[model samples]
Target: MVEPLRPPPRSARDDVLTYIKTLHGHQHHDQLVAVRSLFTWAKQNGLIFRNPAGRIKVGQYEYAMLQPLVPVQVDRSVAVATTPATRLILTLVAVHAARVAQIVTFMLNDTDLGNRRRTIAGRVRPPDDLTTQRLLDWLEHRHRRWPNTANLHPLINNQTANTSSRAGSHWISAAMRGQDATLERLRVDRQLEEARVKGPDPLHLAEDFGLDEKTAMRYADSARAQLPQAAEQPSQ
Candidate 1:
């Protein structure tokens, strides 16, 4: 949620910032152009001395994807995960490639235990056997630890279970602290593993994780790039 600096008034008017925030994706560019044209018109009509919008800067939306970590590193992380909650969090990230944010917001209602499917960010994805088992373990642990807690989020600690708030990203990632692979590295490695085993098709990555096309392409391309390097590495 880190944002670049604001327009400083000399660059653009307040309404332009307000307008950009209301739109999504490509609409930001379209809306900004409209505002710039309005300012240009006002300047030509002698209403304003200068077009602040003319000096306004806009940049294309960008996403950065991390390269996959060594497979053995992630394996060590999974092996070291001992607690039910830690194991479940590791499984979700390593197996399902769930984002920390998405995993944190997950509610008890999001799970269909009998069906072995869970709704994450409005998408229904089935957990593999290991993930399902870890989830059950975590549920049992949570229930035993705090039976009367009203907090709905499935992932909760003593502090969070007492209230309605969910676990933070720092807390969740720190669950695997000192491990070889962090949650982010594990998540990227999951997608890369898929692309390595299957074909490195952007469509497949997009479909699997509900990723945007650009994000999918980056993961796919990284997988394709890593394959040859993996082959070249000396056997241990």
Candidate 2:
């Protein structure tokens, strides 16, 4: 049999990109972002032996993918999800344009509520954008069962001093997934209820609920889209 073809030799920058792309989700994306910035800095400093990455267009890389959820969809999904924690997390991500990591691990000092912002750790420490306040408000309201004490736990515990067992990891994953699924289902159910009690226009519902117009609109649109095809079909 003919020998298999060896892959083409990759430049240092190509190697770096390959390494970063391996980190598909979570904090790895943030790390890759830093790597991209470093590559830029290297180019500026004339340190690049080969600039293969230069040929790559900005926004073209899978590493650069970041899509903000529409406000209405954010609201609906948070509302629909079953777990209070999941709802709060999704709300934080959608409203504040925060990463899922930041939302999950947000610290709450008594002072945080007044200021309406929290510092995201590790990478990408930018303060929450326009939507953060909305998330904070909803989180405060929804997770009232959460202790009034000004303590918060990190969302991911792999790095903690008390390491989790395999069983614990599995349990945590199941619990989190179950909660998230519940929240999504709840949002769908709420949307259906709204349609029955009110009408299809989410603008009115959002206005009544004191949500941002854009977010409300997004929720209404998502809710409408999720409805049964028969219900969505136009009158014959």
Candidate 3:
């Protein structure tokens, strides 16, 4: 007689890992999601005492393939950006490591041009004088174009009166034409640069760039790997 399938025991965690190893890429990630969902539901229903899939770890290499852009690419992307608003947004992401969503949602009140600082996603970041000047210029252009509109965001869609994240992404993509780069890549490049300069302190990453400790560690590790042997050499 054929054996009937039963609820997975804690030992089934091994089987889950084995199954994950057999899959690759997105399929591998998707399988993990499916397993977690199934086990979570089974536990809630009392079909299993614990989630077997909870202990399984997916490898990090798949996600870490997102490479940061070099300095030349960053400059080229900035040069090609079509509009002042788009250029301003690109500069912020490249320089401050600000998220695109945060840029899209930035309001007029968020900026302190006099102080050369801006509140990005609830965090105050001190942008350089050039970035601050670019923003001021963009604001002037925006005011000239939409003198009657009350929208606070400088990068607003004229039709919608507010910019969505998708629209903001499109604006960056349009600016990166011929240059193979994205807002996300620029953000990562900025983070790597920060890590290289600052020696990858998780606290600094968390406080300055608003990244979680774990993510900060990853960036730190990547940065440390890229550091020159001379930099790591102890002081004579």
Candidate 4:
């Protein structure tokens, strides 16, 4: 009987190309381990002569977090902030430790200006003098520019002022495009600052900032390494 026609087998080049598609960090290790197992089984079963992938070497890719900006960078970033909106966002990130998500989702009613308190994603935090001052400036500017705006969100731009929708992350990012430090970097620095002054307690971070366990731990870990020995001592 005639047998069915078969396509050609994939070449070593094809295998190598597939390997290249893997992400260059933890994923590479996982992919190599699976490949090694498959090749070892084939060799033991006499399906192939040897394991071809065994000789390939993969270096470990340890992840490194981006360092916070120095004082000069921070000053440069603040200096370049040309608008009230940008200034408020920067202050929120740098001083209030507000996350991008919380900032975008905040509404006018979320703040108790008289009490110097604000709600971010359901967590109540008392704003410092700087943060409160910036908030007042931005709110006044927002009112002057978009008085007829129906958008309930505290943040509004030309695109969303006429609508009820809140400003997007892209808009927020664009507002700080030329700054030396991004909102995220500033946020991290704020957390790091708190950790430095208050000690590396993940629970405190979680409570204060409404951060998840993982994120709180990451900040705490970074702070633990950088904090001076005197920082851990209780203040008199």
Candidate 5:
């Protein structure tokens, strides 16, 4: 009988890189940092002979240049939203580039509809008038549905005090049927819009969006790629 083959054992660095490759974008970078920290701790305590993840460089920021939704798609999504809460959530993401996590975890005190601003993930974001109005309408609906619930989150379902990312994604996806729209894609579109208007300043992009330099540069690169196509279009 032929002997069965066995795979070779992976070193800590190899293991770490393999795991990192499985993730994408900022998540991959975050996981790499965590893995490096764990390995460093292990080395300091003599748990491992050396810090295997120490010298591993962060993965390159590979920009996926997806076509952004046009103005008509945005308008249609807003018009077709099933409920006030769904409309508000879609507007927040499409207009303000708010992350699903930030929207789900948003506190009542963090919002100032009068000023058209809200603090999301420690950053103050100013939503446009339409978004602010949608939020106001949703809050009224939410209050009517669940009075005296004591939940701080603005968006809530029948079962949970706080909405989850999964729920928010599902709501937006349903509202955006027949259109290519997602929270992450909306964020990228927002970033690209900013880059086009602001002349692709990587440093400013990084600071404004709370992203690392490399990731910001990737946005700048993608934005630069679109300039020629934009310029080629005939003026109306």
Candidate 6:
């Protein structure tokens, strides 16, 4: 049986760099990071030790760069969000591809209906989860203060708020929802990729990809149709 690699204690920090390098290049690089974190935690607990990872050269391995998501993927993820505000936030993150702080500030300033105004005075900062909720509560209170307003939007948090249970849940909810959708899609894609690598049948592959049996069969059929003649031929 294969043993799982766990991070070493802080007292072992001085020797961690060597231990990290013991595993394969990828494992060494990833595990070393985890080890360094543990070492930092250990240091706080009075396990004083020299940080071996800091001292060691990290020039051996090239870092992996993630590819940007396509517009369709971004749209699909945003569509999964429960509310328009959340969806819009998700789209901005996945489309405009702005940072979370920028997204939060933009939406907050844009949607500020209160007498008080918040502007990008200096460095742009996104509000924390609590702040977002506070803003929602504030808007709801203001709407209640002036009931039966000419503009119906004074009462709605997002366009789809009334229909969504997650309405007024978070200020950065659109971004949050988009993130959840993105993760779910990635997980589905990853499972599908793994099933392909394992060469599973359509039914199994469908189950893995969260597809119905008919859809799985159709997908498999399409794949079979696309395979090269030589690859599809029986062994000589």
Compare the candidates by lDDT and give the number of the best one.
1
Residue-level lDDT tens digits of model 3 in 1-236: 99999987647888888888998888898889889989999999999998888877655645553355766877777777767777787888888888877776777788887777788889988768778877888888877876776676667656635433223556545665567667788888888888888886777888899898788888887777777753778998
Each prediction's whole-model lDDT (CA): 0.83, 0.47, 0.76, 0.80, 0.75, 0.47
User: Largest TM-score belongs to which candidate?
Assistant: 3
The runs of at least 3 residues in candidate 3 whose Cα sits more than 4 Å from the true structure, single-residue gaps closed, are 1-19, 24-30, 36-67, 161-174, 177-179, 229-236
lDDT of 3: 0.76
Task: Rank candidates by TM-score, best first.
Answer: 3, 4, 1, 5, 6, 2
Give the clash count for model 6.
1
Residue runs of model 6 more than 4 Å from their true location after superposition: 1-18, 24-27, 33-55, 58-61, 70-72, 107-171, 174-236
Which candidate, 5 or 6, would have the higher TM-score against the true structure?
Answer: 5
How many steric clashes between backbone atoms does each model show?
Answer: 0, 17, 0, 0, 0, 1
As for model 5, its CA RMSD to the true structure in angstroms is: 8.1
Candidate 4 local lDDT, 182-225, one digit each (tens): 78878888987787689889999988887899778777887787
Off by more than 4 A, model 2: 1-76, 122-151, 154-236
- C-alpha lDDT of residue 27 in model 4: 74
Error of 3 at 202 (Å): 1.2
Per-candidate RMSD, Å:
11.0, 13.5, 6.4, 9.6, 8.1, 16.6
Taking the tens digit of each residue's C-alpha lDDT, what string does model 1 give over 45-97? 99999776786766675444447686688778877787998898888888888
Candidate 6 per-residue lDDT, tens place, 9-31, comes to 65544556557657876777677
My TM-score estimates for the predictions, one after another, are 0.68, 0.29, 0.72, 0.70, 0.66, 0.35
Query: Higher-lDDT candidate among 1 and 3?
Result: 1
lDDT score, candidate 3, position 197: 86
After superposition, which runs of candidate 1 have C-alpha atoms over 4 Å from their true positions?
1-67, 228-236
Error of 5 at 143 (Å): 1.5
Writing each residue's lDDT as its tens digit, candidate 2 over 147-218 gives 242334423232331332111233223433534333334333444445444665766655444446655665
